[model samples]
Target: MPGRLQHKAALITGAGSGIGLESSLLFASEGANVLLIDVNVQAAEKVQKLIAERYPNVKSAAIKADVSKESDIKAAVDKAVELFGRLDVMFNNAGIMHPEDDNALNTEERIWDLTMNINLKGVWWGCKYAILAMRNNPTDASKGLHTGGSIINTASFVAIMGAATPQLAYTASKGAVLAMTRELAMVHAREGIRLNSICPGPLKTPLLMDFLNTTEKRERRMVHLPMGRFGEAIEIAQGALFLASDESSYITGTDFAVDGGLSSCYVTATGEPTLPPPSSLA
Candidate 1:
């Protein structure tokens, strides 16, 4: 049987590590041709090689690009079309959680700008170029190809809920992403394109691990997780997979929260989770 994303083409930013890396692998496993974009070209190429070895039938390539730059993002999208013949899915997963991004009073202007550039503005650019490419996508009924595509932006649970230990800039940027996704989805609903945001909870990714360096800092957020454990990158990647596939054809304009119930919790339960976290490496 063919995979869910059979014959489709996907472009994922921040493909070097964390959720982006996991999503790229997962998309390829599901039979989509993948273009991996990241500032760390070597890291992306490493993933490209792994995908080639594991999913030999799928096409995959890596390109060095900074999401914050409009030209770079446009080139990445163009590369996808050039290499794969169409753009079926765009996963704007590149983002930063600067260690110094604290509450507004403590966070500097530079940090705020940096966070918005990568997180908010980056998603915007990705969506813009992806839509342009998707509009001209050639129709191939036999292959289930269409003129429009699915776009998934990486928001955060913090965008919906408050964090006492605030990374104000990160939270605000994510909120903007959610809003932008909703409006775009509405605007493009008439067209075949669909737009949505994925809101991930605190995960054990390098980005969050670096911020929650101390046990005290880790525990502070852990206390609010009903799962009593941080999430995994694979978990979020699974969510992205659903959004990218035709399985979610009717789903659009919503914040798909794969947050381990973090957004729903007022007070977390005391017991530990019986289920172990899933790993992409596994």
Candidate 2:
């Protein structure tokens, strides 16, 4: 049997590490020709090599492009089409969370701008180009590179909820991404291009763990996690795979929360006794 993303061409940003890296591998395994674009050329190349070795039939390429630059994004998207003859999925997963971004007051101008450039503006560019490429391509179910494909933006659960531990810049950028995804989905809904945002909860990625450098910092957020643990990058990648495949044909203009119930929890992580606690004992 053919894979879910068979014959599709996917262009993913930040494909060098973390969720982006995992998604690239998974997409290729599912029969998509993946274009792994990242600022780190060596890292991207390594992933491409690994994909080639593991899945010799899967076509993939490592493209060095900083999402913060619109020119680079355009070139990356174009290269995907050039390489695979069409574009089917666009995963705008590149983002940053600086240590300096404690809150709005503590967040420096430089940090805010940097985060928005990559996380917000970068997403915009990716969508713009991906839509343009997809709109023109005729959907061919037989070939598996369907017309007007899926665009998955990587937002965060922080976009939907306020956090006690604030990374104001990161939060703000993600919120913008969610809003953008909704509007873009609406604009292109009739045209057949589905736009969606994946709002991932705190995951065990280097980006989050490195920022939460201290055990105390990690524990502070852990109390809010209903799952009692962080999510894995592969988990988020699986969500991306669903959005990328034809399985989500009717899903668009919505945010898919791949969080560990952190966004829905009202109780504190303190494990304090509640009125319902007595029922649990019974």
Report the error of model 2 at residue 81, Å.
Answer: 0.7
Off by over 4 Å in 1: none
TM-score of 2: 0.94
lDDT value, residue 188 of candidate 1: 96
> Model 2: residues >4 Å from true position, as ranges?
268-282
| Residue-by-residue lDDT tens digits, candidate 1, 118-216 | 999999999999999999999999989999999999999988886756799999999999999999999998788999999999999899999998889
The best candidate by lDDT is 1
lDDT of 1: 0.94
Tens-place lDDT per residue, model 2, 107-175, is 889999999999999999999999999977766666755568999999999999966687999998999
Candidate 2 residue 130 C-alpha distance from true site, Å: 0.5
Q: All models: lDDT?
A: 0.94, 0.88
What is the RMSD of candidate 2? Answer: 5.8
